[model samples]
Target: MKYALKRIFMLVLTMVIVSFLTFLAFELISGDPAEAMLGTEATPERLAALREELGLNRPFLVRYASWLAGFVSGDLGVSLRYRQPVWDLIAPKLEITLCLCLASFVLITAVSIPLAIWSYRWTGTVFEAVRTAFNQLCMAVPPFFTGILMTYLFGIVLRLFVPGDFPDLHTRFGEAMVHLFFAAVCLGIPRTAMTVRMMRSTVISEMQKAYVRTAISRGNDRHAVLTRHVLKNSLTSAITFLGQTMAELIGGSVVVEQVFGIPGLGRLLVYSISTRDYPVVQTVVVILAFWVVLAGTLADLINQQVDPRLRLGGAA
Candidate 1:
């Protein structure tokens, strides 16, 4: 409980820093929100009024303090684009993004673990070369490129799935699943390649340890040696990578979401950024930062439980 509290406190501190940096970066940008909102035809009086309304006329520190206070109170401010509460704009989309990220994560983990196991089991030969080649190809490509290729081949050319919108999972479960199936595959490919490579390397290295040889010499089967010992010792880095991958999911899925026209947080983020919707952008960035911190905390806790050595490895 005490450790958890400490982790939570650190997360709060990190969020504060993230919020400050986000606000500062946006403020440093050249464009004025009022000008962006009202266009070139905006009069001086109209711009002044808009600034005052949005609290943009206030000093930077004052605006920051107010923004922080409101954020702590669950008020993320009003969106200039939608003229609605930014929190409301994001709330429904949040679940969609969470589902997508989670689905991608699941795909990555599922594919990576099995691939790693297989590669380790089938080391040294043409099959291993094939496995390595596949992983390398997947890892070499970017997510955006993958998304575009998938969309062109699947959506534009073949017309296999709808082009855009939050897929209707309730009624069109199979179709929705198929759409996300491709999206998850694209999102997971690079991540899975990286993860499988890391796990395979780690497992191979762990297998070289003295205890592994002792177990093998004792007539332990391959499965027992791999699962009971090698995997247990090798998964620490994998868990850490999984945590980092969770953080990357938000940003990496942007291209995938845009290609699919999915109403996930990534798409919303791109929209907000393009429109210079400060409240929405700020809220989303802060939320993403909180998620990253949360992922790291959870990973640390889980790793500590699974491997006692991790307790002394510092909170990452």
Candidate 2:
């Protein structure tokens, strides 16, 4: 509880920093947004008027403070491109992106855990070698490229699903997931590979520990020792590593969404950034940052629970 509370405070602090940095970076961006939004050929009076209207003429600190205040109130201002409530523009797409990322995370976890156990069980066999090689290949390939390949094979050739035709969640929940499955595959494969490798390494390392050796000397069954002792102990590092992958998953979702033609947050972020839609971009960045930090905190809690030493105020 103490650790969780500490993490919660830190999350708030981290979010403030992220929000400030995001706002500042856009403030520093070259080119006058007001002038750019208006025609270059427009008169100076109109440009100045536009700048005042958009609050571009405000001091940097003042504008940032105001934005932060609005953020705290759950008002992210308006999208420059769409001229709509930033939240309204973001909410639906954020849901889609969250769904995609969540499905991918679940799939990766489901696949990697068993595969890791299998690899550990057959450590010296040809199966281990094959699994390692295949995972390495998957890890080497970028998600965007994999997404394209998946689209070609499944959507173009196999016709199992259309490349970018995601159905609305409300209208057809089942059909939407079906289309999302392919994109999730692209997002999950590399993560699955990474997790499997992390699990394998951690398991091997745990088996070499003094406690493990002591258990073996006591005539404990090797398989039972692995299951009852080592597996949970080894999973701490793997969980930490898996939590780190959320950043990559968010990034990959952007390119994968584009490749697969899903209108998720990633695609929205890219479009908003290209259009100099600062509110939209800032909102997305902060949301993603929050998600990553929250995931890290959850992973830490899980790790602590798995290893009592860690739970004891992280003595180890």
lDDT of 1 by residue, 46-79 (tens): 9999988887888999999999999989888999
Return the lDDT, model 2, position 26: 80
Candidate 2: residue 108 Cα off by (Å): 1.2
lDDT of 2 at 249: 84
**Residue 184's lDDT in candidate 2:** 93
lDDT of each residue in 155-239, candidate 2, tens digit only: 8999877777878987988878877888998999988998988898888888889999888888889888988889888788878
Worst 10 residues of 2 by lDDT: 307-316
Model 1: weakest 10-residue lDDT segment is: 307-316
**Could you tell me the TM-score of candidate 2?**
0.93
Candidate 1: C-alpha lDDT: 0.85
Model 1 clashing residue pairs (backbone): none
RMSD of each: 2.5, 1.9
Residue pair clashes in candidate 2: none
